[model samples]
Target: MVVVKGQDTSEPGGVPAHPAASASADAGDEAAEDDRRPSPDDLHELLAERGLAPDDVDQMVDVAAVGITARWWRNTKVEDWHAGSAIGALSDVDMYRINTHTTAKVRERLRRWRREQGLHTMVDVADADPAPLNRVFYNLYRWFTNPNRTLIIGTTLRDVVAQTLSNARTHPDCDVPDNVTTETELEDYDNQVAGAAGYLLESMDEYDPRSVLYSPALFATVWARRWWGLPDYPSHVDRVFAVLADPGHRTWQNRPIPPPPDGVNLVDVRKKMLTKPWELPDSVCQWLINDAAEHYIFD
Candidate 1:
C-alpha cells in the first residue's frame, strides 16, 4: 500500500485531519514526526540503541541500504517484505533497525499479506551431490540464515526437461534421499527427468511437478520467510530467470551443461522458460544492487 502524493491527510475513521492517529504518537501529537531521517550508519546506531542483534543492524541494514526507493514501478510489498524478514532475523536489541533500515514499523507485518493469493512455485536444493567447484568457483550459494532448504531450477531443454521428468518417475522419492547418481548415464538420466515433468504436466488435477521446477532456488529464503509469515515468492518472473541464468546458478556451475544434445532446440527451450511465469523475493534484486554498490553482499 502507498499514500499518494498530495493526498489528503484526513481519513474517515483513520486519522483526524490534524495528526493523532499514530500508534506511537504522544498525547498532544497525533503521529510522531522526525526532523531528519537517519542515514544507514545512523540507523545501525538506532537499532543498536534499541537492543537489536548486531547482525540486524550491521549486516542486514547494511545490505538493505543498496536499494533506492523506486516510485515509478511501484511495489511497496517488496520493500516491506525485506524490512519485515530482515528485522525478524534480528535480536530484540536490534528490532528498531526496521525503523532505522526501512520505513516499516510492523515487525512481522508482511507474513500474511492478502495479496499473496496468486499461484507460485519453489525448489529446495536438498544438498544434492554437486560434482565439484573449481578454484575460482566459490560455493557462492547457500542459505546462511536457514540451512535446511531446497532450491529449484526451470528448464524444458531436451536434456534438462527430460531429466526433470525422469526425476519424478524413476526416483518417485527423488528428493527424500540424497545421492550422487552418475551423469555417466546421461541419456538414461535425461529420459527419467523428462518423464517426471511430463507426468506432472498430464495431471492438472493434482499438484503439478512444474511448481517444483518453475520455482527453484529459494530454499534458504523460503523457509526463513515462511517462519516470518511471508510467502517465499519473487515479485516477478524475469527475476527468476535472471537468477537462473546467472553464472553463479548451480545448474551452470555444477557440471557444464553440455551443448544441447544433437538437434535439441535450445532456442525453443530458452524462449519457453523466459516467457514462463516465475517469481522470487525482491531480496535478490536488493542483493544484486548491493553487490554493484558495496562490492559484495558482505564485506
Candidate 2:
C-alpha cells in the first residue's frame, strides 16, 4: 500500500494510482469529500467525550473574545467570530499558524512545547481537571491562538496555574477559581521548573550559540523560571534537591528527572529540559529581564 500524507493511494490488484490521478479523483468526488469532513455531530461527540455540554461552546466564545487580541479575531471580523463555532475557531488558529512565516524548526519546537504544556486539542483543554467545564473553556480560549508570550519563557499551563494561585494567595480580590491548583501542586511545579533550570545551567556550553537558546526571540526563556516566581538559583537548586530527596514526592511523575547518585530509584530523565537559567553576567541578565518585562511580556 502506498501512502501520501496519510491517505491510502493503492488501486485494485495492489497497484498504486499515480499521485496526480489520485488527487484528481479525490477532489472530484464531492459526496465522498463531504463524508470525509467532520459533522456537527462529530464535533459534539468529541466535546461530549471530554464532558462538555453543548452550551459550553458559547462560554468558549466569550472567553476567546476577552482573552484573544489577534486582529483576525478582534477587528472587523465580529460576524466571522460568532459564525465560527469553537471547533472552527481552533481550525482557524491552526491555519493561521500554518500560513505564518515561522520557520519549520520553530514550528516543531512550538509543537513540542505545546505538547509539554498539556495542550494538544480542544479535548485536552476540556480534560484539565478542577471544574473542567469552566477551566476547560479558559484553557481552550487562552491557548486557542498563539500569544506572543507563548514564545517567551514561563508560559506553561502549570506556570499560569501556579501564578494565578500565587496571585490569589497574595491578594484576596484576585478572581481565580478556588480549586485551580493546590498549594502542594504549586510547590511541585515550582521544583520541576527549577530542576529544569538547574539542568540548563549545567548544559549551557554544550549548545551552539546559533541555537534557539541564544536567539533574541527567546532570550526571556533563559530566565523563565525566575519570571514564574523562582527568583534565585541557589535557592532554586536547593528546592530541586529537596524535591529529589523526597522519594515519595509528586514532582517527578510527569516531568521526570535523573535518579539520585545514592541509588534512589526515580523517573527516567528526559533529554534537554526546556527550562533555561541565565549564564550571562548579572548586568546583562537584569537588562534582558527588564526589556522582556517592559516590551515583551506586558506588551
Candidate achieving the largest lDDT = 2
Q: Global CA lDDT of candidate 1, please?
A: 0.24
Tens digits of per-residue lDDT, candidate 1, 30-107, equal 223323222223433443453333232122222222111111001112121122222211222122122222212111
Q: Residue by residue across 71-159, what tens digits does model 2's lDDT show?
A: 11212111121122321122222222221212222334433443555654434433333232223223333443323224222243344
> CA lDDT of each candidate?
0.24, 0.29
**Candidate 2, 64: how far from true, in Å?**
6.6
Off by over 4 Å in 1: 1-34, 39-42, 49-58, 61-299
- Model 1, position 182: C-alpha lDDT score: 24
- TM accuracy, model 1: 0.16
- TM-scores of the models, in the given order? 0.16, 0.18
